[model samples]
Target: MHYCPYCGSLVIEEEKYCMKCGKELPSDFDERVTSSKSKWKWWKYPIIISLVIALFITVLFVRTQQQENDAQELYQQAEEMALIGDYQTSKEYIEQALDHKNNFPTAKAVLDFLKIAIESKNTINDIDALAKNQNYEEALDKLTAIENNISGFKGDLINKLNTTVSDYRNNILYQQAEHKLTNDLSKDELKELLWEVEEITDEKAEVIKEAIQEKIVAHTSNHATELLKENQFNQAMLVVEDGLIYAEESEQLQSLKTTVEKEKIAFETAQEERIEQALTIYEQEDEINRNQAVEVLNVNASVSTNEITVTGEIKSVATVPINSILVSYQLKNNDTQILENDVYVFPETLYPDEKGKFEFTHFNKEIKNNDLTAEVTKITWFID
Candidate 1:
């Protein structure tokens, strides 16, 4: 294909204008890419069996028997050329048949499919070259562009194009799967790649899909196992949940889920016991007051180009010593529209009538607006 000299957009030699940039193509650009692909290779030849064409001819000849005309002869000649893998000659014959009989519907349909057949044959050649060089992205792009328009093709032509599309798509996916698996992409990225492979609906997709399934299940289970050891049960569960979406019946992933659930229940039970014991001690010391005893005070916010810094003072009026305080806040715009809700750990303990300060910086280089103010929503504390 020729490229637009002005914009470098790809354009076929037959195109008068660039599809991407709409620029007039230079005449010299057509000289390089207009070489005729006149014959299909022996292995790729014979897309439609001769028996089917014979049957089609028998039916068409009966319909045109009364005319005994030039159009009928030209149409038969086109089918003969097509059967021998001469797509360009066959398309020319079909076009001649149409010129002889402008009102012939059967000839019109044959011309449409003939054009698609020629295009499909040429496309497969280009895809072969691109695939040989491992240029899968461009190959896939070319296939997609052809597919969007070939839906109107009829008869053996559609079957030929479909086979071409399916074979190349699976080939590309299989190679891509092997190449990408050697890289260091995250599980989600790998999963996305395999999900495309899983769509082939043919045995070609299954081979690589099975390998990807094992990798994802094992990788996710190992990650969740590590998180469980660190007492991060919730995050571990999320990881296992993601893995199960790709391999729902995986024993490793299911076992990981069971282990995470048991761990979470045990941890929450222990946490409740600790809180109960601490509350009892505070009550015995006549220092327990259970009615929302933590307050956020002197909250201030500052905005910069890359950051929104929120500093706040917190006082504990609870009956017991509180540590690991959690603060939830919202950032709102000037119109009182909330933009984000987040939490910050106060990082210190506070006893009754004691105060502590916290500073949280949120916005990043990717953040578009840092002109938001902070709104404290909820505060909670726990004993050591």
Candidate 2:
């Protein structure tokens, strides 16, 4: 038997060419032949199995990730519902999806939203209870709070609140008007008149919030006036501020604010002037006392045609031990200052037991107004 090396087939021994490959083999073909057995290692089967296992793991991991994403989407929807006050249904949805998902952010968010919603619901209930008992301020405060706390309120509720506020404001106005109308009308007759006016005014106020202009402004302005009368200018200003919030651009309110500001300025100016006048009087009195307390070293100076001399003495009894003191005298035009003199007492120390005198001579200039005044400055005392 013979085999063709190219095609690996058997042939007759006498054949010169291979029957399967149609190629001629050399007579020494055995020397050139090598083994045709498979060279694949045995561990290749394990490598193939590992590739298959890795593909299976990859598919499973992707499926788990998809499921987790779906769960997170459901939890987000549940939280949004809870925030809008749909707690029961939101809780139901979250609980249903909780088992399928781990690390659910919306689960915690939903719980927190539900807690806030429930608390707000309780607060509204409390307000309702108070409102039933006619505790209007507390009820109104809570209603305003609910408006702030809730993200959105129904249009119906908002309209209802508007009507309620209108009614409350009109009721207050009617009561005030009734107090002012001191006529002897029958109770039914007076009540009917005020009721009709309130209905018309409230209807107008619904269309225009500033329709209650006179009442809102007059009330606040009157209060401000009372404050001004009581000399409480700061409080009066606060009253005007509160009034303007309701009737912000009302001409009446503006006028009232202007009036209050003017009054406040006038009051402040008068107070300042009074204080200044008192200080001036006190300074004059202090100067008089100082001059009287000083020891008279000399009085009455000789006046020549060209010069005049004046002498003064300072006693140490009421003065600190000062090295020197300065005295200033002034000359004035009608109401304006024209000239001044600063006379320094120099080279002398005034102790408590000692006294000192000085003489000053100054030339006189003819002027229309001549008023002489003296004051002291830079009276430094040494710390013993």
Candidate 3:
């Protein structure tokens, strides 16, 4: 038997080459093959060791790349979640990324940022809860604190929270105003409530203010109308005036005030004219004699701090006895404006040429040195 020198394969002694490895045998085949095998054994160990080390390096590189890819994917997921305001879930993803690559700098920074974001999200949620619970002042305080402290924090979440707080506050104010309106508040109280309602800068705030204004105007108008019916013109004007302070542009109240003023002027003018006509009739001697009425004489007026008193004498000039006689008197100011007018009645019968005493008293503070006039407005004769 022989072995090829180049390859460790057995062959017949007559063969020139080994068929298995296709290597030719050397002369002095056994010694050459032995020397060749021994020399190549050390070379095979080095090549095998080199091949094993290269395979290990390649596997390690592939695994490291896969881990890096996983970490990057987690970071991207964290970023997406953070964009959607899911800070808690984003923080979890970022922490997982850090786990994959413990020393990743970008992941570290993102984790820090996510931590802040989570805190802000939690704070906003707490504020929402507080507002829902109607603890609006506290919620506002917390929100303001966050706004003052956190720079560049005006994102969608913060904006939404601010709007929510604002709406809630306005809603509270509107409800309070509505409640106040339900009560029978005075015009001044309603005015103050309107002021408060106007301070609310919400969409519904205008509606609330308009409703309050309507209530004020309606109430004032109705009250003034009642007063006008009772001839309390001064008090009615005061009510309308107060209502105008709340509803400055209310046409209803303005019209009511104008009507009151006009009626008051007409009433005063008519009274003055009636008094003047009564005085004219009394002054005409033929008219008095034709009517066979009473004559007013010895008229005098006395004034005091709070009142004016007018005393006069009336003589029945009728042919027969009169059962009743009535005298009307007018108190005039310096401008000839009638301050007051009243009638004095004598119920007892007065025969011809019989005299009767009449007096008129009024609480008129403005009754100064002015003319006084009296006339017999009525005479009743007894039927025989």
lDDT of each: 0.76, 0.58, 0.72
Tens digits of per-residue lDDT for model 2 on 227-330?
98988988988888877776678787788788888998998999999999999976775554354334444333344555555556655544335455555544
Model 3, CA-based lDDT: 0.72
RMSD of each: 39.2, 25.2, 18.5
TM-score computed on alpha carbons, candidate 1: 0.50
Which ten residues in a row are the worst by lDDT in model 1?
34-43
- Stretches of model 3 off by over 4 angstroms after superposition: 1-158, 229-235, 248-251, 274-384
lDDT of 1 by residue, 202-269 (tens): 68677778878888987898899999999999899999998999999898889879989999999999
- Off-target runs (Cα >4 Å) in candidate 2 are 1-45, 48-52, 79-84, 136-213, 216-384
| Residue range with the least summed lDDT across 10 consecutive positions in model 2 | 375-384
Q: State which candidate, 1 or 3, has the greater TM-score.
A: 1
Model 1 accuracy (lDDT, Cα): 0.76
Clashes of each: 1, 0, 0
The candidate that achieves the highest lDDT relative to the unseen native structure: 1
Better of 2 and 3 by TM-score: 3
Which candidate achieves the best TM-score against the true structure?
A: 1
lDDT score at residue 32, model 2, on the 0-100 scale: 26
